[model samples]
Target: MPIPACPVVHFELPYRDAARVSTFYQTVFGWQLQPMGPEMGNYILATTSTCDSSAPDALRGSINGGLFPLVPESPLQQPSVVLGVPDVREAMARVSAAGGQVLGEPMAIPGVGDYVVFVDPEGNRLSMLQPLMG
Candidate 1:
């Protein structure tokens, strides 16, 4: 098999109070948030500008997921997802223009690059990251 040009690299969580969740992350770890896709119920995504303390300039990220209200049918926080992006800001703008929400602007992480979070039309949480130069 051949390597795909692009791949579905990560999966993330789904939350109901997207705004609240976004805020939670922003406060906890200083991440930015962006909303995506009203057709999917104000789905939001998130990203981080900071890198791991050990590796200040490293691009530290997991997968990306979504945030939507827990359906009475499905009750759970789901799993946290990590995502990858070449450029966090560009990805955010693209997502927002495509009907996604720009929940928060990019934030710096001291020695790390910049990051932002966002969601899709389906309410899946996602993150974007950019590494800072030495």
Candidate 2:
């Protein structure tokens, strides 16, 4: 289950004001935004469900990602770069075997897909997705 080194990571939206932008996304895309931490009022990750709202992050009902405040110092690259895989767990192993590091664990998203974030050996941020059956 070794996935080739894909060229995409994720589509990141740069927001100057997270609260304002996150609210907009919640209404427009039906995405759920959870506060990253108390100290990070302006920092939040967009999700497909609220805490205790639905299936695990990997089993959610649809493809989804996060929303965070824009950091001027960070690199700028947004291009709908989420990679689709057949099995996240397997993909994670393949990635690791290929010298990649898992940025996060596989998350279920109800009937949508399962996914995880990782970094390649070349320092590229990416995500792996496996759509779940309805």
Best by TM-score: 2
lDDT of 1 at 111: 64
Q: Which ten residues in a row have the lowest lDDT in candidate 1?
A: 1-10
TM-score of 1: 0.40
lDDT of 2 at 13: 58
lDDT (C-alpha, whole model) for all candidates: 0.60, 0.65
Tens digits of lDDT, candidate 1, 31-119 = 66778666545656555543444666656654343455566684334554444455677777778888877558876645656766667
Write candidate 2's Cα lDDT for 1-134 as tens digits: 44455433334455687778878888997887776664544446666544335545554334445555666786533323468776678788888999999876787755558877777798777677777755
Cα error of candidate 2 at position 52, Å = 30
**Highest-lDDT candidate:** 2
My TM-score estimates for the predictions, one after another, are 0.40, 0.49
